[model samples]
Target: MALVGPLLAVVVLTAAPAGVKAGELPWPKWLVAGVVAAAGVLVAVWTPLVKARTDALAARTTREAEREAQAEAALGRLPTLKRKALLVRDMNDRALLGIHEAIPLPTDSDSDNTLSAELPTYVPRDIDADLRAALEARSRTGGFVLLVGPAASGKTRCAYEAIRAVLPHWRLLMPPDGATLNEMVAGDADLKHSVVWLNETQNFLAGEDCLKASMVRRLLADTTKPVILIGTIWPTFYDQLRIRVTTADEESEGGHAFDKDARGILELARRFSLGKWSDQEWDRAKEMQSVDPRIRQASLHRGQTGLTQILSAAPELVHRWEQAETPFGQAAITAAVAARRCNHPENMPIAIIEALAKEFLTDFQRATAKEDWLTDALMWACRPVHHSGGIAPLQAYGKNMGQIDGYRVSDILVDHKSKSAPIPDGQIAPDIWETLAESATPQACLLIGMGAYSAGVLGVARSAWERAANTGNAEAMAPLGVLLHNEGDAEGARTWWQQGADAGNTGAMTALGAMLHDEGDVEGARTWFIRASNAGNANAMTNLAGVLYHQGDTEGARTWWQQAADEGDADGTAALANFLYDQGDTEGARTRWQQAADEGNTQAMANLGVLLANKGDIEGARTFYTRASNAGNANAMTSLGMLLSREGDAEGARALWQQAADEGNTQAMTLLGIALDREGDAEGARALWQQAADEGNTYAMTVLGVALDREGDTEGARALWQQAADEGNDMAAQALRGFIEVEE
Candidate 1:
């Protein structure tokens, strides 16, 4: 029985992993030998020891097998659309009718009537546009994109948009969420090769939910697919963000300046969406501005102020039918909507509203069965939106918080009258999950709700990390340490880091090493870094070289930097270029930088462009700089701004520089200061230069010193020049000595 038990356990355990080939696993040998050994040990003096060793070996084997399985799973990810494409191609099937099979049919009532409530196709997909573009590019070439956006800033919208765009390429196997971000990134997609956009990048990064980072880092190594990460960070978060800024003034200025008061959402909305508001409508909207600014300003269609987002997003029938003209008109509609909602709360879903407003005369609607589409839309709209940050829970009806109890609508209304619950709670629970999970099959219907809650909670899970860490789980430790590291609690993260590292957690080792290095513990960091590097953590190797370089270990830095460069760190390439240039190997530096520039490092492009321009390769420089500018490089913006200003677009150039300065670019500020001074606003120039100098800019110091000298503040100018000179500014130092008459 004991021998049989061992064989059964091995067979059972192996089944979960690639199913052990029949007889391939030495089940009988191990089982019989283990049983005989156990009996002998029991008869002697080591039953406990033998059992412990056996169990430990079994556990390790299981873990190793699980690890390999997870790695394989990680390698298999693809977004939803691409998966469909791959399926179609591989199976020699062309029919896409199966896609809609996942959407549910309404059981309580006819879904046709509800299909009227989804956002119209015309609803702006800008939130999704960038990523969708990236995703499409990735379909053929492959790459990964990191998308960042504020809560409700629409990361998922972008994901869906990409799905729609890549619908035609059904031959590519893209899973709904993609196989893995790492797998996507391995393609080396950029503007040229692939469209790789990540939505809600924080969720896709160093978090328990995101296991794709390793593979993504691997994808990042690809030269063919360059990825752009899009996200929205809180202002403070953005402040902490580090970007290598080096644009021309004109391109850098206008958009990102730090004014005391930011442009409010209402103001931005008005600018972007209400520009098409009619004269009378605008006046009416102004007249109807309520005492309550929150309500009046918050709604996209407050009063008659702008094109009714409701009307704009509405299907032609509703647009023509519902006219919310005066305070009376809006009030009437609100009253009607509210009255019916209270009366027929059951049908008051936003999906119905959206469906009612969308273009209904389309065959696509027919194909998906409007009923199924409406059912899907309703569920999607009704779902809790946790990532909208602090946005009030979106009501199932409209942007306004009216439930027929709050207001009413005058337009075509369906009374959602319900006297009592229609079914038992258990019945409805399964129904809800079944309807919703139908759209995505990976989640089991019975387990649908549990899966979603688990996914969401796991996505941000951290409180449970310590427990998981104590239990020796690597995934939990890697991200918890990362979180601590990010929070500036490096020491607090160390214990877990060591535990995880010992357990083979690559991310923990990399993170811990980075933390130690950052705190000036180079030797301690190097040991951890080496372990991570050996374990295939590219970031660790790159960071190790950086630490070495900073400590002036030239040869050590070079050797490690080569490892990082081989593994694809643009920073490694840039650093090597600078190092070579500093060592007087200009030709090598230029060539190396040109290669990096070709890989879409905006800074490299700008640097190479500047180099080429200085060497009179103006056309080539322009080409490279233009690409860099388009990628949102502030330095390139500033450079382009300067180039444009030289060509006489002074105002435009000034505008660009203004943006860069706002984003805290001191270099751009210095340039803008000079431009203003040249334009006769000496005081403005002085103010800007002072700000830049305060930001630790030596160039700004030189400019301020020069300006102060020109303004006749000779002593102050001398002090400024001396500061700049101390930082190796030859011009400032030369002028300082000459002005002081201290040097022959």
Candidate 2:
């Protein structure tokens, strides 16, 4: 427009002078000038190129101004809750797609060139990296993950972490306390790529079919938008794949409610996440005999289908768990034992509670026996936080909580010497260790690893107990004896064991009996064993029965074995299985073997694995055989080798048998010798057979005898046969008889 005005003025000036000269009766000077000006303006008006360029310039100028204004507005809106009111909201954009609503596109005004430099953006919170990447790839893919916790255990905070991670560019959406569900999904379009975090969601769901609840139902049902529900309680969002983040109750609630909340935490620990033990802040859950008798024998394992139960009926257990550390893995072990106990009440007689406890200890192998004591201490420490609805969670501190039931949360936090930042290392160690020593002597500090406490714990189990014994406590003497025995000082163990037994410590009586047996003092062993056995030391009875059997006291052996088995010893069960197998009770033997195998005895596992295989349970056999191999069962190794060979893996089979042979397993050595022979290594096979024969393997002796006979040493072969015959090899006896008959 500026260019045209100047050009027109110049033309009008030049044309006005010319018009006066060219026209006879030219119009007035002013009129002629105006006419010339109008002609100059018309000159460019009809030119297509000029008009097109002019329109383009005008449009560009308008857009530039609009963009600058938009950027300024966005800068003004920086870091506020509501998004900059998109004044340029495009009506052309579609509202909804297939299931999810379409997120609107940024307008031209959002052009970076015009974006205000003053706008400061907030970054997303750092969180679980893998989940972050997945969400980014899917463009705000929305799904439900169950977030369960005892009240105030930080369930809400975790949900916020997920939301903050995914929506880095957006401002935080911290809904006011007691917000309606409608407010939650109100910004549906923006939240399509963001999360609608509903805090205290349970209260929103309290009255069903209400306007707020209806909004919640619709939002969840939409499935395309990410929605997070944070509540003090549990929720049900159906027909969706979900993840559960379970937690324990915060230290706030007092009285039975707090205890009940702790119980719920235990239930979540035991029932979810694959039955592994999870330590809560201040509680321990372990398997113990249930007060109810009917439940005592029940075989139903908890947490088998973990998240499944959580998504369905998890709310029921929210308040009943009382133990600090819930034994989650116990249920599976309990079920496994219950089935066996019910089936073979005599041979396989471990009660569900006993088996479950054994399973608990076995599963956590790296954990110490003193760790159990720690569990009890933690439970006592958890004793309900006294304050509720406080701004901060309570912290336990100081020498005297003074019967602390409930105190000011801030008082608890500030009262400690360290100002409640976590008890100082110097103080916590001494305090916990000192308090622990009251019940657990320093020598047996369960959770204390090798450190400053190592002197008190690992190397002092006996010394600490000795002081107790010197103070005239016989029970302490019993533990000292066990410690001495474990240290390989049998004489010292005997001394304490006798003292403790004279004081009527039954555990000491068993130790004395065991030491006597090891010393080849059978009469003394028998007397102590009787005392221990009568006191219900099943270990004593089992050991005594083995000795009786060796002495040809079959009736006495049977009596003790029955007594031990009835008391639930896996060893006793295996012994009974051996006897039954000899008596032609194959079914009874298999059942007993299976029972013993469940107790983690390698020999029983190998026996069961072999028997199950012969009975044509190939898959079950393979699985068992693998377990047995893991347990270092040599027979299982040889059996697995043959199975693998049949499956066309001869080399693999050879490697397995060789491993067992390397472990000095007689059966494995014998089988490896056979495998070597089959592979055309006769000398190597003979060498292996020699090793096995020297180990008193009768089958190996027969193989050696045959090898000697083949080498043209008939007398040497006969000698080998005689040795095998002495070891009860029927084939060897027949071979010797046949040779004698032939010679006669």
User: What are the lDDT scores of the predictions, listed in order?
Assistant: 0.43, 0.43
Off by over 4 Å in 2: 1-483, 551-556, 646-648, 680-683, 738-744
TM-score of 2: 0.43
Residue lDDT tens for model 1, 1-744: 110111111010000101111111122221111100000000000112234335545665665555556544643554334443232223222112111011111234333343322221222333344555555565554444333322222233334444545533343332223335443333322223333333322223222334243344454344454432323222212222222111122122111111101111011110101123345544544454342222233234544322232222222213322332222222222322332221122223333243222322236544544445543533333232223221111123345565432221322221111232121121223222222333222211212222322333322223445445655666556655644554566676787777788888766776666556556676676777766665546556555555555555656556655665565545456556656665667688788677656545566676666666656666776687678768877666666665565567778778877986887667678767767766678788889989988866765776677666656788898898789778656556666766766434
Estimate the overall C-alpha local distance difference test score of candidate 2.
0.43
Q: Write the residue-wise lDDT of candidate 2 on 112-223 in tens digits.
A: 3432222111112222354445445444444333344333223344344444556555333333322333433433323443343344333322111112322343344454
lDDT of 1 at 210: 41
